[model samples]
Target: MRLRSCLAALALVLLGGAAHAAEECPAKSTSMDDIIAVLNAAPGCDRAMKLFEACEYGASGDVQFGEIVEKKCEADFLGHLKPPQKLSYQRELRVCDRKYRNKSGTIYISFTAFCRAEVAQRYSRRALKAGGAGR
Candidate 1:
C-alpha cells in the first residue's frame, strides 16, 4: 500500500513539472520581426546561426550533397532556433521546410550570411527586390 501511494505521488509530481514546463514555453509569435527579435534575444543565436550556415553549405547542391546533409541542416537550424525545452523540434522543422521550399539560391545565400553585416547589406537589397525580405 505504501509503495503504491509513493508511485502515485511521484507520477503526480512528474506530470505537474511537465505542465509547468509547457506553460513556460513561449508561444510562437506572428511576423518576421517578432521571430527575429525572439531569436536575437536567445543566448546561442550566433553559435546556432553559425552551425546552420555550415550545415547549409554542406547541404547545398554545390557540395557533395545528399539528403543526410539537408536533414542535418534542418535539424541543426531547428535546434538552434528554439531549444528542445522550449519547442518541438520536429514540428518546427516541418513548418520551416514548408516555408522555405520554393526559396531562391540568392535568398538561401542571404540566410547563410545572416550573422555578417556586410553580406547582409549586399544581399538585403537583392532579397528585398526578390520579395525574400518579408511578406
Candidate 2:
C-alpha cells in the first residue's frame, strides 16, 4: 500500500526525465527498444526487472500501472508530431489511459507523451546516478 504509493511517486519523478529523453530519442519503432534499454540500464539488472514488472503491471488486475501510462504518453506525443515538418521551438506532451488482457491476466495502463523537443541530455548525469537511464 504505502510502499506501492511511494514507488509510484518515485516512478512519476523518474518518468519526468525519461519522458524528455524519449523526446530526444523520438522513439520510432526501433527506438522503443532503445527507450526500454535505457530504462533497463538505469538500475542494475535485478532492480530494473523489479521496476519494470511493477511499472508494466500492478498487483491488482483492475489498476493501471506506470508502464502503460508512459507508453500512452509517448504515443500521444508522436501522433501530434506526425509529418515531422510541423516541429517548432515549443513542445508539449499528452497522455492517455488504456487497458489490455491476456490469458494470464488483465492489464490497465496509461501510455502517451508528446513534445517538440527533448530534455534527455539535461538530466543525463542525474539519471545515470539515480538509475533512470539504466546505466
Candidate 3:
C-alpha cells in the first residue's frame, strides 16, 4: 500500500515537472531578414561559415550529410555565388546529386546546392510580402 502511494506521488511530480519544462521552452521565431542579413553582410568565406553553422544547428546529427554540411560544404556554395550575392526569389528547374557514404549501398547521402535566380527572386518577393525582408 505504501509503495503504491509513493509511486503515484512520483508520477504526479514527474508529470508536473514536464508540464513546467514545456511551458518554459522558448518559442522559435526567425525572420527572412535575419537569414538575409547573415548571408548578405558577410563576405564569401564568412557567409559560408555562418551558413554552415546554421545548417549544423538545423540538422539532426543522424543525417548523413549534416556534419559535412556544417564543416565543409557551406563555403563551397558561397564560392560559387556571384559577388554582392543577395537572396531573391523566382522558380528555376534544377537537378541534385544524391551521394553515398562508401562502396556499401546501405548508407546513402544527398548534398545539393542548386539555387537559381528565379527561386531567389520568388523567395525575395514572398519575403517582402510577409514583411520579412525589405528592399
- Which candidate number has the best lDDT? 1
> Candidate 3: where are CA atoms >4 Å away?
1-29, 55-96, 100-135
113: Cα error in model 2, Å: 16
In order, candidate lDDTs are 0.39, 0.35, 0.36
Of the pair 2 and 3, which is ahead by TM-score? 3
Candidate 1, residue 65: lDDT: 20
- Candidate with the larger TM-score of 1 and 3: 1
Stretches off by above 4 angstroms in model 2 are: 1-63, 83-135
Ranking by lDDT: 1, 3, 2
Global lDDT of model 3? 0.36
* Residues 22-63 of candidate 1: C-alpha lDDT, one tens digit per residue: 422131543334434433433432333333333333223312
User: Candidate 2, residues 1-135: lDDT per residue as tens digits?
Assistant: 999999999999999977765423222333345446544443333333333443332334212223433342233233334354224212322212211232243322212211101221222333354444433
Q: TM-scores across all candidates?
A: 0.26, 0.19, 0.23
- Give the Cα RMSD of candidate 1: 17.7
